[model samples]
Target: MTVIVVLAMIFALLALRLFSVLGRRTGHEQQQIPAPADDRPAGARMPAGEQQDGRTPAQRAAESAVAVPAQAGLRALIAADRSFDVAQFLSGARAAYGMILEAFWKGDRETLKSLCDADVYAAFDAAITERESAGLTLDNKLVRIDTANIVDARVDDGVAHVAVHFEADLSAVTRDSSGAVVAGSLDDAVSTIETWTFSRDLRSRDPNWQLTETDEG
Candidate 1:
């Protein structure tokens, strides 16, 4: 009878120890799991209000790179590269749009070469060459960028590509060799919508993105 009582107490102590160990392990596992999905990447620092609720800086920038509800591609991109930020990207894209357009219009091959990939630069070069052959010059100006939004984003094979939809007003003028206006009017700014895709190698240390593709939105 005493042996049976002793065995029962021993089993109770072992069960209590097992339960305590399991509880501690479960809590540790939960801590290892990350918080819910957040659009903001890990590296960049933000102002006080910007980090609230895991919301991205895009929310404050008024242009969400992940789209309003977020897409699978954008999510995948964030997963692949934690440093990607839609807001900063959109800002840089706006500047690049203006710079690339002005360079193409001015026949600034050096600028285009630096900002564009090989294919895009080649296309721009061809157009510039054709224009020069025809003895024409362009005086184009980017009036203002009304909106630039990220429409799509993806990471594939360690390369990241992001598509931005831009709406802007531009004034373009074409002049003949004699410097007489031949085409387009600089007085009238025309609204244009275009989608441009930019790409960067995630593994590369360079943060700059190259213009890869362009199309009418």
Candidate 2:
């Protein structure tokens, strides 16, 4: 009976040792396992706002040459090398025209310097000059510009072809050679659509598109 009791106590100790060994082995196995890497390719999706790309945010911004333009402006007007937006272009042009005309009326040289191309500047400046010489002033300003559509808008070899319908109401007064005041009257608020063609001059760093011609109807 004492031998049986001794054998049972030995079995209990062996079982406890086995359980301790298993627990230690489990911990060691866990330690041997490697941590997962976070790096991944662009195609591989990561969690939100996480960038797996090797490039730094600044590097990515610099490397990315294309911009998805949301506003109509000079950059959107002619700086684009890819597909151009006609609506954006026309809207920008009309906005530019309004500002430029306002500048001319106010004799703001800096505004004209920024917005108008050389020839466009020359024409506008000449008009202002002639009006000044004749003691005439712009009575009513460009209040509205209604653009129908760009019938043609295509880009080729760093050049874009755009023909747009422009309709606007502009009013100004002119004096006859006689020293008599012609009572100002609205001139029928004329309705004429013009299809203007523009071409880029490669020589200038501005790469500004200029009016090539106009088809008036």
CA RMSD of all predictions: 24.1, 31.5
Model 1 Cα lDDT, one tens digit per residue, 1-217: 9999999678645543432221122221211112343645866565565455544453544443336433566657756766554554566677778878988998989878978999999999999999999999998999999988778777889998888889999999999999999999989999999999988887876666888999997
Runs of candidate 1 with Cα error greater than 4 angstroms are 1-70
Lowest summed lDDT over 10 consecutive residues: which window, candidate 1? 23-32
**Residue 104 lDDT in candidate 2:** 81
For all predicted structures, in order, the TM-scores are 0.72, 0.45
Q: Cα lDDT for residue 66, model 2?
A: 21
What TM-score should be assigned to candidate 2?
Answer: 0.45
Who wins the TM-score comparison?
A: 1
Q: Kindly give the stretch of ten consecutive residues in candidate 2 with the minimal lDDT sum.
A: 26-35
User: Quick one: best lDDT, which candidate?
Assistant: 1
Score each candidate by Cα lDDT: 0.72, 0.47
Please provide, for model 2 over 10-95, each residue's C-alpha lDDT reduced to its tens digit, 9 standing for 90 to 100. Answer: 86455434322211222212111111234344375544543454433432442232222311222333345322333334444555
